[model samples]
Target: MHSDRRVVLEVKDVSKLYRLGNIGTGTLSHDLNRWWHKVRGKADPYAKVGTINDRTEIGDSRYVWALQDINFKVYEGDVLGVVGRNGAGKSTLLKVLSRITSPTTGTLGYNGRLAALLEVGTGFHPELTGRENIYLNGAIMGMSRKAVSARLDEIVDFSGCAKYIDTPVKRYSSGMIVRLGFSVAAHLDTDILVVDEVLAVGDADFQSKCIGKMNDVSKSGKTVLFVSHNLAMIRQLCNRCIYLENGRLHSEGDTDLILGHYLTKNSDTARTFEHGPIRKVEVIPETESIRLKCHYKVDRIVHIPNLGFVVNNQFGSSVFGNNTLNSGMSANREFPAEGVIEVEIKSPKLVVGKYTVSIWFGDGQEDFFHEPDCVEFELIQKSTSQFAGSAKVGSVLTDCEFKISAL
Candidate 1:
């Protein structure tokens, strides 16, 4: 599919090296050594000694390669998704592409103007008003004052910060900064948009708007590079995906194919026990409630066996949890040697998505059995409410009553 499209960006043999424990080569001697190598037209003396950027393992080397030997081509109008574990160089790659940092080893070729939102308040001056920062960003992107002025109202409205547009960005909350930053980047006259996980700081509504804006940008023949851990958003936005591991491009291809491989490789199956007391578990989602059924077998007698479970979203964050004792249920007698335990989570305001269930069985004194990600299910919205298809903010929905009164 990429064969027919024009290549808007190309990354060739790119790598970024950083010295451990200190910035810029760590010492005067090391800096001199690197300078000496550069004067002699030799490759970086430290670059060769840097280890791959793997945070899990302790390495003997003092230098680490944040990104190494990366190569990829982004076609015009392509929405490329970058996925990786936390320290897998996704951010480094985007920084290199965005020109926030230079690659240690290779070059980046850009066919058009590039704008990036790598962090909250990435290009904003804290003392500057949000309105002023918008113009500053436009100026940085090489846009004229008239052009920026033409889009100022649209940008401010999209950001939802009109009430505080004249206030200094220092006083703006993190979420507000993100809203303005994203709005400026999207509305600016840039040909390629690069966004990191900074969108995670925004509320769900802003995130949905950012996603929609990126889609519009792509449809307008601009390229986009998105880095996110949210697989759902990645699947929804990207047509092509690249998986990074240990500072390298592990694989790149169709989004679903790459996501499947990534999930299979990084699945939390290792956290589950092989021979636990809980023999089987099932998580079934219904219109109004979620049903959790656990079948267990135990040889020893357990007094007042308490059954508890936690529901985690796809990102492994605990959404909510409940147990027999906490829910005002009484199981004072001894538990059966073998039996099925059924639990109905009623009226849970869960966002529509996939979730995993982790179970714990124990008495009031101690925990007897525990398993993480024991079962998985999807929550579907059945009510025909006005906000049914809107992007949800967090893991669970809130039931709040609103009141407006005049003094």
Candidate 2:
């Protein structure tokens, strides 16, 4: 469907480099070296020497590549989602695309005006009133005074800050600031919108409103680039996604495919788990039942550890959960030093979709170990099932028997 749409934004071989310790090259010698290379019309002497942006390891080089040879295109009306761990360079990629900072290599091509809400109060002056800042932002986007005035009421109403529209922005709370900033960006006359994780500051209702507005914007043939750690929101808002790892685009495709890959990979390495007794967790999803195999190693002896698990859907909502105590297991005996626990949940009645498992080991008195999103799996409906190929009605299927009685 997107094949015929015009490309609104193009990023070709884009990369961003940063020095480790200080803003500039620490030594005059390095500065001189860079100048000499530039004077001779040569490539940056240190551009190719930086390490990838991995925060866990102590690197040997002082230069790191926040973005490396990134390439992608945003078609008109596309809502592209960017996902990654903290140091995976997601923010850097957004900043580069938003033109907040220039790439060290390659170029960006834009066919339309761009407006970004990268940070809270990104273009707002602290001393200016909320009412004035809206006009200021419109001016920055090249809108005329009359044009901004025409949309002023809509912006203030959408922000839910009409009561304090004339208050100085410096006095506004963080949530207020985000509301006004997002309102201005979304209401102003712009063809492309670039939003980072700043929307997380707003309340839940406002976030929902913002998502609805973005959806409207896309339907009108505008483009959007969104970055957030909230996988659930990404799944809901974006039709396509890109995963970044170590300053490079690791994968890009359909939203569900990328999210599945990310969850499975992170679980396999236990990267999201805290150091504890739980070593590994495996989940097997079936039409009739769900199987869980947990591996654990205990260093200190504790009175009877109760093993439990909770199954949650992609939206982070708990579909169902249980612990050993509730399953008629005795809690009088002590836990083994190292062992595996296997659990089979019969007739789970889960609807077709993806789910994640969170495991916890704890004594009746105190908690010992816990891991969230330790494993992820999907459930497929059988061909003979009544609800096969039907639209999802709820998170779980029910076995209700239908009958009618005459009153």
Candidate 3:
């Protein structure tokens, strides 16, 4: 992939401005001004002024720049990972690249056909059958009927939805629709693929399959722009990464370095309430399961506060967790001003990786204290598997034994 690489896509100063307000034709004066600017070959007055896209704050201008000064060059056979917090304009960037929407400013130059899976069912008509949608997508991509017919069997087999191929896509589940949609995008004759959080909707096996497919595509001298919150998948599939923050390109370059910066930025920021103050949290590994102990100070005497913990993998996806009430256990004990609570997870079946723990102190209905990143630990197996560290499919590794018998 590294040999004889050339730039396949170039995005220069791309910015998308969205006006916030009622959706309708603007006042007559504004429309005339826009037309006048177009006649004079001048920039639209509205494009010059816009606030940063911060949903939490109110700006003087009704317009917001969803993307600002975003520039990147993607080379042939490069798997570029785009990552950021929610509302970071990752999807907007992809939409612009896919030509589903045009940027308010700047230009994009690229070579070859581009295919995107922006959402679960972006191109499909709900009333159409799965089989019909495949053909429709091919037509939309400007492919001949013969071309799509040749690949129909491969698409159907990859989707694992042959049984429902003739059924209306509206009846299919989200996961099934994603499988069918991804299979089409992957098998199409496109030089570049833009995918947005496709693994977020798929099952563990399906996610593994999709990652493998993307890997194969990269190997075939194609470009991929992947946007995902799943850092593990990004690290696995992407050779380059771009981090966007507040609708702007914050950092771009190596994958591991950028991911490290992202994790550090989101490490510690949890809301606290009047219920209690958690002093410290620790996760200790044991032979069977891990032990999570919380040392806290209770300000006032409160009835059994529900104590729970959530474990998130390095990709920032919640893997496994349990609350006392949900687990059929009640901690209705009176709390002193200061105390320690220890919860032991039985058979913690997590794959070997670095994981962050988020602890919660709630009163059944409301959260008293929430710590997003209370502790971090690595899960290591005492013994390696027979395959010697083959990529684990998902975050959890269930306990089971395999046996073979003659039929």
Candidate 4:
């Protein structure tokens, strides 16, 4: 589909398999058989023996395929987002591209140098200082000492660990380690960058900074393969996305459409509790306020201490939250066997973006029903404000009159 653009990476029929149990007894035989087939230019014999990776069920075979018949292409300067549920073959695909592991079948063709930060402290030595490891990683990437020295200061400053540059990596916290690792990988002049969910180890501010750096990298005409559970980041940082499910390519297309599909597929609406006080939960978005409705039925008197919703933006940041206790509602009362309770959040001014709502019902310490990502909706600007082009961008909007005073 990207014929007009030059391809940077190509993956064809890629698959990875792992033995389920112990690896001692029949491993040698399988390895010898694989080598025999390779010498004869035949397909891998074990490729036909593995089952699809489904964590909820046990398969008949002893081997499982982490990836199967996976295929896609990454054009030069493309920021590709890889998304799926846990154990969905995302990391395995990246490892194959990074050459940390070879596919059991098929092949990968990539041009230019590639760098991967698949985990925190992936290529670091615990005994080495941060400064030393920077060069060490550069050396491992086939760069000379003089070449690494040219970008050493930029890496240290971007990592925000300049003061700890001389300290051994063992002393750094997990966040610091990730910061340094990402800084090195991003600044090493690699044509292709592979990043996993390891960015989650850093704090919120650091994560934002790293996203900004990735944006710069994409603008500089390099290729990026980013994998994360944070769909909002994927939407903002990537122009194209790949949705992998059950070790296969489910869909691949534009960022917004793919994310919509992913969110719809992973919604937790089917959750239920046995004989619980609550019966239903719903969120209705209105122009002025969001209407939350909770229907319930009870045989005996029941008291609920807390009940309300929490709103979060795309990056999973909590925008606002409220509960019955904090709103001065009673917890020592009973409700009708069949009745509806409604709460209105009035004048919730928010920016133009998608948001998710989580509803909870129970006491402060204990929960009767807590549903996350129950509803997702977008807020759009009805009219462009005179100040819309201003640099003060934020998720929340407020109505205030502007005044100017003479000096």
Specify the highest-TM-score model's number. 2
Compute the lDDT of residue 27 as modeled in candidate 1: 72
- List the candidate 1 regions with Cα displacement exceeding 4 Å: 270-354, 357-407
TM-score of 2: 0.76
Q: What RMSD value applies to candidate 3?
A: 7.8
Per-residue lDDT over 185-249 for candidate 1, one digit per residue giving the tens place of the 0 to 100 score = 89999999999999999877778788889999999999999999877788888989999999999
Q: Candidate 2, clashing residue pairs?
A: none
**lDDT values of the candidates?**
0.85, 0.84, 0.83, 0.83
C-alpha positional error of residue 381 in candidate 3 after TM-score superposition, expressed in Å: 14
Instruction: Report, for all candidates in order, the number of backbone clashes.
Output: 0, 0, 0, 0
Give me the displacement of residue 17 in model 2, in angstroms: 0.4
Given candidate 2, what's the lDDT at residue 329? 70
Quick one: how many clashes does candidate 2 have?
0
Question: Per-residue error at 171 for model 4, in Å?
Answer: 2.1
For residue 24, model 3's alpha carbon misses the true position, in angstroms, by 3.5
- Could you tell me the lDDT of residue 27 within candidate 2? 85
Candidate that scores best on lDDT: 1
Task: Write one digit per residue (lDDT tens) for candidate 4, span 90-151.
Answer: 99999989999889888898888899999878999999999999999999989999999999
Candidates sorted on lDDT, descending: 1, 2, 3, 4
| lDDT (tens digit, per residue) of candidate 3 on 57-84 | 8889978899999999999999999988
